[model samples]
Target: MRAAKGAKGFKIIGTDGLPGPAGGIEAVAKGGWAGTFTYPTGAKEAIEMSKKILLDCATSVEPTVTVGTTAITAENAKQLMGK
Candidate 1:
């Protein structure tokens, strides 16, 4: 995920790509809300590039966490939510 402080508030983005499905989420941290988008295949590169842009925006505001498959499990989600 990536996060940045926007003119209105902070923004966060999350992305993932799987064999037959791909999706991403863009979030505004100020109100703890988000929106999502999905694409079947051809837009993979664009999705990835958008993620990079979000990360770049975040770099100026806060640290970012980028992890592979193993770290995004239900157990981890629970742990993070607990904090």
Candidate 2:
């Protein structure tokens, strides 16, 4: 916020639209950002694959996994934030 103070036409686009006081949601809600995005870490997928490899003794799993993401802007930020 301090960096953009008194600066004209400055915009902030953040990542990890997480919850909490200091997260991207709050930043956007407070007008400190134009928008933000959430990046899935694929931890759940990794765990599931591990289970298949260990329990099922799978020979191989999918070579790649695609995670999903969400875009948070003023239009939906408030709704996503449950505000």
C-alpha lDDT score of every prediction, in listed order: 0.35, 0.85
lDDT of 2 by residue, 1-83 (tens): 67686688768898959877878987887788899998789999999999999999999999998888899888888777753
Total clashing residue pairs per candidate?
0, 0
Q: Which candidate is the best by lDDT?
A: 2
**Runs of candidate 1 exceeding 4 Å displacement:** 1-4, 9-23, 26-33, 42-83
What is the Å distance of residue 77 in model 2 from its true position?
0.6
* Per-residue alpha-carbon lDDT of candidate 1 for residues 1-83, written as tens digits (9 for 90 to 100): 32443445554333332222122221222223343222235355556656766865544432443332322232233222322
lDDT of 2 at 28: 83
